[model samples]
Target: MLFKDQVDFVRQHIKKNKLRVFMTILAATMGCAFLIVLASIGFGIQDTMRKEILEDQVITEVEVYTNDGEALDISKISAVEHVNAIVQRTRMDVMTVSQLENRSLEGNMALTNFAEEQKSNLKLSEGRMPTKDNEIIVGYQFAENLLTDAERNQMEQNIEEEAEPIGGYKESLIGKTVTMSLQSYESDEAFPENWNFTIVGVTEKPAKDWIVDTNILLDDSWKDKFQEVYNASVEGENPDLFYSSSKIYTSSLEHVKSVTEELKGMGYSVYSVSEQLEQLDVFFMAFKIGLIFVGTIAVLIASIGIFNTMTMAVTERTREIGVMKAIGASPKLIQRLFLMESAWIGIIGTVLAVIISYVVSFLANWILPMIVGAALGEDSFEELSMTFSLIPWQLVVIASVISISVAMISGWRPARKATKIDVIQALRQEL
Candidate 1:
């Protein structure tokens, strides 16, 4: 028989056994869907993790702190290869007046110049950066404490009316002046609560694992005011008027190592997430392996269905097979025909699986956010519901392997059984 004739015969057999074909196709579809969903979720999680590591330009920069007199010389450090620039700023955990307490609360605040560092890293949910010396931008938690401090101070002084809060939350601190106590670090005793600054901006709380809170972003003008305070304490002599740390930004791994060593020698501590970031790459590798393991089980079940259907088809066509052998048909030809039927089933299963997987991925994209929103509230869900992208190559490879292997295994036993049939016995049995 011609190859085309064998293919046509397999197609006819599948058409005749419509129910069996449907079941096998359904199995293949489910298997594809499983593989696709797992792959999508794995890649989605990796993307989200990458955002946390790379977005906002967080990982590209390293912050170096110095409390001792060991802070590096900025000019010497800048000469390192691939070191683009360094942003220098100081942070001190000082008291900000808590209006709720009417007394100063122990709060740590960051005093940074908004001009040097990238703005995106400092997330501004509302308001704008401080443009003047007296104005300051604070974190979400710090803003809340400032507002509470205002209310408490008002009550303490027998003042009945305080400014009406716009939305009844800490978010109302925008565009208002709040009191925070600034004292010199040299003084062991608490300084008077006299310093006050306007709330020009409110930034999102620092990242979850951030080191400081109740932070402040101040322009050059505010730094001058801090300088004045320090100078006064030191009897008009320069006492390093402003205390600051420097951050180096770079993309080259070689430069990172070199600069880190140089900075370390200059009495500065080197800080980066290089180790933690590498863990994410390891996680995705393991995840893809695990998904393939699960996919293998689905393929095994489909193989059994293929074997049973082929075996049954062989039994029903026993008399037809005997007549063919009586007409000088070779056993090899019969085996080839059975294998062709199995291959066709494999092809059908694979096509169905790919179609179903595409549909499922679309539905998941539409429905996942709604479900998350209902469970976690709209605001929280908004942050969590990022885009989902599919892995096409993974889908194609997995689907093809699963479908073809199942069919080949299923067709093998029936082909062997057909080869053992005696033409005389098969011809006399039923027909």
Candidate 2:
């Protein structure tokens, strides 16, 4: 038979059973739409979580500390297999004030040693990182306590009245004079009476407050002075030689586990975000599979509907099949004709589903952020940067293939029945 004639015959049947064919197409479309939407949600969640983990810290970093509460020695970690770099941060808990200011603004602060030898892993927003003892890099809330009570009150009033974004005050505090005092929050005595500092830089606003908080990065030369002052004040078995807690960066992500295990063997407790991320990958894989499985149930129901429709069409068109056979139509042609018809139904359904799913995804991604921003009020800057849905081209192709395959498979028995019809028996049917 001519390809044109085959196409014409399929078109006539589709036109004849408009309602039945249309219903089959609708079922397939609904199933494909549901599957795409669900898969999109799954992929979006995975992408967002992966981003948060990666941006949160270096993928190769492992945080290790001694079990005996002693300061970790860099020599020991450096000697560990797979250990690439060691950042020995000296953290001294102290109180700080914006020096040379008459209002006497003070806030809670901790100072950490910043060395040229190691990566700070801190994102800077303005100015340059402090390279000298007299300079400092500040963080979120660096200027919060520097504000006088009246200034604080007025800032709050502006936010309440005008809905200003949070942390708007930090940008203005750059280049201001700051002073470090070794006095604990409860004491009036400062180890260094009047050591002055200049605010050289500020960090990018972090997702978590603890990433910055009131912590300031100071020159590494001051670590010894801090240790001496801290020990004189508290009197421990040993002055903290190195930071009690240390961050160790491995050579690569693949080496994190090996380095962590090595640290544990050396009688140290170790932690890494990379370890949690590995588990996260597994969980998301399972989560996505579960979502697709549920969506596949809808596809399965749609396939069943298509199957029934095709079976009924065969019964109704038995006489037509017999007449075509008597007119010298081959069984293969009969089978090909039915498969082509079912494939057209599947393709039409897939196109409609693709259109509907992407439109909905676009609207969801655009609108959800707006709703969340409105709800956050003055703290909207802390809102997460994420879209609820994402539809990749991979999903589009996979859904199309799956839908058509299901339709062709479902129509198999019916197509074969059309091919095997006895001319005499089929011509006796009512239609």
Candidate 3:
């Protein structure tokens, strides 16, 4: 068939069935638009969840410990290709006797940079990580325990009972100094070592017990010297355990497992964030699949509507098909004309779908916050961030292609019927 003749015939057919063509195009447009909007919703949700996980800290770091009574080579781990930074905490046990009004909190001290990998896991309530060895960062609960009952209640009132205690306390004690009478313990023996701790930072209570004892910040040389002095003066059983605990920071969250796996190969017991991240990714992948499936159902209904319209067009255009055949149009030409008509419908519908998708996406997002926020009360949901729809170029392209293909497929049987139409019988038929 000549291209010009096919185009002419397609235009003629469309002109004759204006109402049916419009409706079919509308159905395809609605379907494609529905798919676009749905996909955007899926992407938006996935992006939001990913941000939350990162904020909570992903599997970008590992904590390494020993299976036996020996220290793993920190140099070897640091030299690993994916290693970004490394933090090794050397611990000391000190009995803290308060020099202020009668109260005390006993815990071990450890060193940290407060940057790099472990930072996200330890959210500060107030102040900052200590740069000096004498400054201590205490857990909110640790400081709270030191507070007298009257002081505690007064704090609850001042900061609001529901306010994060660590944040409140950290702010409350910034630049304040506390004096401690430290007792050195060696195995079962003890000696007094008077010391002072300035509350430089307050950290939110951690999920683990060991984190509570990690307050003192010592540099490497300071750490080694303190460890030596502490061990020599205050002997303790299982001193080797403190030497085993080390933190390995990776270049990124994804590299954490690689470093941890290497450590495992060298015979160290390691815990990493990568495992949890993988599990979360798998779960979200399944959720996105389910969402796409649900959204595809709407598009399927639109495709069926297109099919119905195309089938009716075939029946209505029987006489027209006969006239074309009589006028020297081949069966292939007739078939091509029908397919061309459906393609045009798909093309036009896709254009409309793009416009509709944008409007729908905006209205949906804009209306949702206004309605929900008003209902929930404005202040209650101020912290919440959500994107109701996120339309990317990839989604638009996919939706357009799918819509066009579906339109052509729906017109298949109609096109075939037109091809095989007996000229004599079709001429006698009336619309």
Candidate 4:
């Protein structure tokens, strides 16, 4: 048969049974729309999660922490293939004070810029990282906390103690001297007020919540001062002094294994980012699976609609089928005709669904920003660009396959019934 003639015949059949055809198209359209929307949502969620996870630094770098032991042999770790550099970091909690105002501050203490030969992975979003001893760089959260009314009042009380109530110096403290004290942890209950530091730079807050709180950067040149201040706080008592720790980094998984081996040889425990990343992957997979399971139910309902519509179409076309068979149309030809009609419903419905879904995605992308901004107390949603990104090839294949499969399943029984119809009985049935 000619393609145009077959299409015309299909159109004529549909036109004669307008209600049935409309219902079939509606079912297919609903199914396709649901699938496309759910898939887009899944992709968006995964993309957002990945961006958040990798925001701070590259996940490829292994995070190593030090507890209590001999330092891992750098030479042995360096010998591992793909090993590039190792950076050691140490941290402690200390009292910070405004040197200009002489009031104690609250923050975590960090010492870095350790060895001149070592490469650093530390990044500064504002002022430079501290290179000199006593030159502190505060994160954004620290700066905001320092500016609060409670802290400002506490600083003023110190001024009252010294009889140097300098209101003029309050503004100067931003760029002026800030001191940090290194005190004994054991004697903290008896003599809690004894460590100090000098502040130099303040920068953007770290993205990770844990890293921003109680963070103060320092250098190694002030170890003597740290010890001296620590001793004074203990008042000749052999209280436990604050200790420092180091973290070593490697370039690759091979390097991490090498470093782990060397650390084991040195009688130390070690960990790597590979384990953390593997856990993260498992988490994402479970999350995606759960979403798909839920979304599948909605798609299943849509498929039921397809089945119902096809069944109705067969019942409505009983007379037409009987006439075709009476004219010597073979059962195979009759079955093919029903299948083609069902296929047409699937194809046209999917095309409509694709167009409608794009419109829906576009509107969501535009409106969601305003809603998010209001919820987050932000002026704009510039940070959160809600993308309506579709996996085009995957979507295309999924939609096409789903549409055709749904059509076939819905038409199967109807096609078989149409083929089995007795022409005499069908013609006699006016009802």
Worst 10 residues of 3 by lDDT: 162-171
TM-score of each: 0.66, 0.80, 0.73, 0.68
Descending-TM-score candidate ranking: 2, 3, 4, 1
After superposing candidate 3 on the true structure, give the runs of residues whose Cα lies further than 4 Å from its correct spot. 1-5, 68-70, 90-109, 113-153, 157-192, 196-216, 220-245, 269-273, 364-378, 429-431
Q: What is the overall TM-score of model 2 with all chains considered together?
A: 0.80
- Candidate 2 has an lDDT of 0.77
> Over 4 Å off in model 2, which ranges?
2-5, 55-60, 69-85, 93-100, 103-113, 116-121, 149-175, 185-188, 209-212, 229-243, 250-268, 368-384, 428-431
Using TM-score as the measure, which candidate wins?
2
Cα lDDT tens digits for candidate 4, 1-431: 45677678777877887776777687778777777776777666666666666565544455455455555566765675555566554554444433334334455666565342134345555555555555666655554445445557765796778754322223322345664444334344433444344555555556765665446666766556665665666545644444555455566445565555665565556566545555766875676556545644555666676667667767878888899899988898878777777778878888887787777777777777777788888865645645644445666567667766777767777788889988988888787
**Would you list the clashing residue pairs of candidate 2?**
none
lDDT value, residue 175 of candidate 3: 68
Candidate 3 lDDT for residue 278: 75
lDDT of 3 by residue, 230-283 (tens): 556644552532442577777776677788788888888887767666787798
State each model's CA lDDT, in order: 0.68, 0.77, 0.70, 0.62
Per-residue error for 92 in candidate 1, Å, reads 2.9
**Residue 136, model 2, lDDT:** 81
Backbone clash pairs in model 1 (N, Cα, C under 3 Å; residues 3+ apart or in different chains), count: 8
Residue 407's lDDT within candidate 4 is: 70
Scored against the true structure, residue 240 in model 2 reaches a CA lDDT of 40
